[model samples]
Target: MESIKASLPDVIQQRIEDLVNAQTTDEEMAAHIKELGCRIAALEALAPEEKGEEAGQLGEAVHRLCERIRRDYVAIAYRQGLVDGMRMDKLAAEE
Candidate 1:
């Protein structure tokens, strides 16, 4: 995770840290995570396509990190949705 963080663009890294630390609502956090995933995917796509051992290794590293972050974001969104649904159901029951 540290290696992944180290490779991230500085602005992205800072934004991620801020989001994690802030007292944000679940919807906001989930939205930010999805946005981060999209930004990372765009960056990965825009990276210069090079052919070499070093380039191959770097590409693999970036790919792995991007996938990991995307998966994490999906998990967060799923959990948030589940919790929100449960809360709604409970509120409906009370009414």
Candidate 2:
């Protein structure tokens, strides 16, 4: 949705593009993205009368999805030795 695009932070937009273009055998990233999309769609499907808490829950779901993507990105980067410093605590923080 255009509104959704407008609402997203630029960093998040870039991250989504990066994830889509990333070269890897793992299908989990794509699957996770798909699941997030589905959750967003479900949120959109909610009745107009049922807006507050349902929307909040959906927001949290999206946050969790973003966190997962970040974790996976960090893990893959660490595995490839792309970055010099790898900390278990950083990865654990995502959970």
**Candidate topping TM-score:** 1
Model 1 score (lDDT): 0.62
Q: List the residue pairs that clash in candidate 2.
A: none
Give the residue spans of candidate 2 off by over 4 A. Answer: 1-49, 82-95
Q: Cα RMSDs of all predictions? A: 16.2, 17.6
lDDT of 2: 0.62
The sequence of per-residue lDDT tens digits that candidate 2 reaches over residues 9-55 is: 55356557776877644587678667877767677666365685778
> Mind giving the per-residue lDDT tens digits that candidate 1 earns over 34-84?
786666566556666653445555656766786687678778867866765
TM-score of each: 0.41, 0.36
What is candidate 2's CA lDDT for residue 90? 40
